[model samples]
Target: MSTETVNPVTGKIDEQALVTKANRQDLRFAIIGFVVLVVVMATLFALVLDFMIDGVPRISGEFLTNYPSRRPEQAGILSAWVGTTLVMSATAMLAIPIGVAAGVYLEEYAPKNWLTDIIEINVTNLAGVPSIIYGLLALGLFVQIFRLGQTILVAGMTLALLILPIIIVATREALRSIPLETREAAFGLGADKWQAVWMYLLPAGRPGILTGVIVGMSRAIGETAPIITIGALTFIAFLPPAPLQDTFPFVNFDWLNSPYTVMPIQMFNWISRPQAGFHVAAAATGVILLSMTLLMNGLAIYIRYRIRRSSR
Candidate 1:
């Protein structure tokens, strides 16, 4: 058999030489990949070590509960963390359902027409738009027009808009991954459209949907520009309203209108301050933020694995 290449200098087919060359190419690619992996691992290791050295000492109960103060030693992240949690919770609640519903409609129900084409194009375009633009849009529509003010509700809603396109795209892609025969089989079994979607499609698509949601949320948690543009206070000394009330109506929404700050905002404020202690505190806060993001990603992976196993 002839080899893949002939020697240009000798003008002869050399099968052994060609095989050696192919092996070398493969080896070189593998070596490059290994180097890249090593570099990434080293970077993460360095970051973790730095945080531990500078931040661990400051990670006390007092630091967790104390409010922001002019003194670096007295400042804490209570309001910042609480605000982050509340805002993220609200964002997830608003974005996930709406985004998934829109995705389902686009993928399973919408007609293949110019209108749908326009919508698809817009959705894709929206995903790439600068986050600050979404902030501006939220500022104009939610804050200025609707008069929501600079509050947790407005911030959560803004972040929801930021991640909506991502979730929708992920949902559509997940739905597409299901084999067409599966849907056909469901229909053959006398399943209606809603039944087919809810019973067969959504469950199979859950892994991808969950992956998208967590990834989008990671981005939301790190966002600072949009939140700042919407006037989130960097120094939120007071906690927002409580979820429960002692009065007649048990639930309270007053927190939605209160001022808030998130981890990123808190870190920003600390890093910008003229104090070494504050800088260390910022590093500690980063460790917390990183931990949260990693935890979310791990959960997504676990859930996805379970879904795949169940499907199998």
Candidate 2:
């Protein structure tokens, strides 16, 4: 038990004694929080280590380069990885500019009205919506109405929809973190709202924005349900057409309309097979998927660090 003391000289509560008691409480809480963090980290590390142990030996050049096959020994992730790369590229190209622009408009330009409030609330709520829901929606809209088919474009659009809310929220939060004084100073210098946001606020908040983009993409990469729901093939042996051509107007858009499968879908297909070798292949795919996610996050962190260092 702890006791509070009164200062005999001033007939007041002892500030130093109160501070000591508060510090003790804070220290106890801190220790508890640290213990919880360690437990979570250790658990995650163990799971990842198990995957690595099962999968690392199976990873090889041929495993990466060959297409999926009925024979587990011959099966590889070439088409899946290539499709994933193309889809992610399309998703990033579509989502970033649109999400960022919507965020900036909502934060800096939108009036504080009921309609804006509803939109904001909806955007926030959409972030928690299941990926499968987006898939169903995309199937109805993009696939049926737009006749996009179960192609890379439709897949990218679906994932883009899934991650848009995340990027918007991140962008708004990043912009909001800029100091009021900074905004005032920009205004005082005769800079317009657009100039202030484009020049100062964006550069200042880029690290946070990039972090959010990385997080959203990481989530998108391992998503299987949506991709499956959108009719991604379980066993695709063919690659998308090359984006570059030898003829005039060399950049081709044919690949966007090509049937595709992502890493998660490929892994799912492998896991569903009864063969133990396929299970091993699934574990290896998980390892590769995890590695790709980590590499993306690492690259984002490096870029953020560089941005901060340059700004300083």
**lDDT scores of the candidates, listed in order:** 0.90, 0.90
Per-model TM-score, in order, reads 0.87, 0.85
Q: What's every prediction's RMSD, in angstroms?
A: 3.5, 4.9
So what's the TM-score on candidate 2? Answer: 0.85
Clashing pairs in 2: none
Q: Which candidate achieves the best TM-score against the true structure?
A: 1
Residue-by-residue lDDT tens digits, candidate 2, 227-259: 888899978999999999999899999999999
Model 2: weakest 10-residue lDDT segment is: 1-10
- Clashing residue pairs in all predictions, respectively, total 0, 0
Q: Local error of candidate 2 at 236, Å? A: 1.1
lDDT per residue (tens digit) for residues 175-248 in model 1 = 99899998998999999988999999998898899888998898899888899889889887889989789997
What does the lDDT come to for candidate 2? 0.90
